[model samples]
Target: MTTTRSLVVPLPDTTATCQARRRLDELVKPVGSLGRLEELAAWLCGAHGTVPPRPLDDVRVAVFAGDHGVSAAPPGAPGVSAYPRELTAAMVRVFQAGTSGVTVLAREVGARVRVLDIAVDAELDDVARDVVARKVRRGSGAIDVEDALTPGEAEQAFSVGRAVADEEVDAGADLLIPGDMGIGNSTVAAALVGASLGLPAHRVVGTGTGVDETGHAHKVAVVERALHRVEGRVADPFDRLTALGSACAAATAGFLVQAAVRSTPVVLDGVFSLAAALVARDIAPDAARWWLAGHRSTEPAQSVALTALGLEPILDLGLRLGEGSGAVQAVPVLRAARAVLADMGSLADLT
Candidate 1:
């Protein structure tokens, strides 16, 4: 766990006069045509309480996983047919081995990967090493049957997530990557997003790990039923997350809230992760100020969710892969942003 003591100083105006002047002199034609990135650099200069744009160094990805009780639906979930909660635990172990698809790519980019078992049926193998096992419950209630998570479970999930973020910050993590790995999480993700954004179930749902058309339609129907079950209190994001969210979304929301308070950067993955980010943003709109959309997911609701957050995805790549793969893939682009600000020579010297 990483913790840094913060000394709040009266807001100081740290202007990038030299940097702006150099940009103005550059041959790019416009003073700041790159929009958000240019603004981001300027904002970073001010937020640094100094100049020269020192970028964040310690980057970590927190991938939270859980099992959805609703995954047991028959005739619809024709694939596994049994409880998939064990599969969630299995994937957590795979991620812990540092050889999983995501960990391999994450290691390449120097990003430390950590897995959180928010809720699952089976206990993980190596409990102490790197996997965070803060189980909220065995699994969420069946979506079509009842509330996914009770209010207490929802709050507990969020508290655990916040504790994780606080610990990560204490351990020197400068930037946070919030991701998820529950087997049937996409179902809960779509239900939550659809309810929050008031989109139709058909519009919000998508295939998770390759389901047939019948399964896809059934997924939408289940989400629609969940929406009906948890209606009337749309004002509270936490309420929405708890009632409709997976443990992963609850955890991710917790991380986003803590990062916003600490003034750390958060890289958001696709719709599932971003739905949690949205929950955080709703609670504290300022939290969004620290968000960077990592990539555009092939999930249908992803673009709508990202646009709703006012974040532009850095990469499209036609990627629907979860388990933080897309977000890890975009790390180099963020590193590139830092390199441009830190290493690129100003036009004054070039001329």
Candidate 2:
């Protein structure tokens, strides 16, 4: 596996991207007729460092599961997620049993699914054996009152992500999908997005897991408090993540950075993944070159992150599922994009 003591994001192959764009124009379809698919094909070429990219046959989805200390709040308490913290561990079991939405969609798209136990708060015996263990901590601290992680713990989480990316790439994964499963993670995501993009907490916060108006208001307040606590102290992306992001977000960012360094493409899920991507982009500005936004999550923070990253989502089905379900839904679209480049005849050949 490739090791990076500190993440060094690599630049994409622009020459390959140009070559692929020319090839797309020469296809039987009119120039730009295929819209985003053509762009996706060209992007694939850039990411793979080839004119006509290989099929994304070796696709893998890594769902990093953790818990947020903020989730420890009772249902009626401020900053609580709609679901209990135990749901984090329970959902890992669901993923392990191949019963989750991500599992079904990965199966549909011929992608392999691996659940990573990043930092779930509870002890999970049955699901523990099936997951890739890389727990950075028991769970992240409540950001509303304190830093989510110490700088060292944040770095450790980032290293965990980078290691996961290296392992997947070395194991023959050409394409990666990042998913997150941590109750109250959206709160963390909102805080990170708000801090990174200079947006207000109210604008970034959303009703995670179908929170009612009262819960939504409470979440927003929590995010505002977190942002206030970290104001003027987030000197860089790493600091921002350490201050406001969850363990899962830090790991996801690290995973994304390493994937780009290895020249592997990644499909990003919802707001949590986007929050991580924002931090990764700050760490390595060129890392965005390897990522494709899989969908537009209903979460407001997702839009902020996508806008900041300049990524247009392939799907916009109002999806807010966090277990990489939205990214899995986008796999078929990427496969179809690849097919357009691989199977379509050139205009000359058609004539």
Let me know the TM-score candidate 1 reaches against the reference structure: 0.87
> Where is model 2 more than 4 Å wrong at Cα?
1-6, 75-79, 130-132
Query: Whose TM-score is greatest here?
Result: 2
The digit string of per-residue lDDT tens for model 1 on 261-339 reads 6666677887778778777777667778677788988887777788888888878888776778888877776665555
Per-model TM-score versus the true fold = 0.87, 0.95
- Candidate 2 per-residue lDDT, tens place, 1-351, comes to 223455666778899999999999999988999999999988888887886788888889999888888777754565457778888888888898899998998898899999988888877766656464587778888998888887677778888888899899999997999988989889999989898888899899999899888889888889888888988988687788788887788889989999998889899999999999988888888889889999999999999899989999999999988888898888888888889888999999966
Q: Name the TM-score of candidate 2.
A: 0.95
Q: Which stretches of candidate 1 lie over 4 Å from their true place?
A: 1-50, 75-85, 129-133
RMSD after CA superposition, every candidate? 4.2, 2.0
lDDT of model 2, residue 199: 89
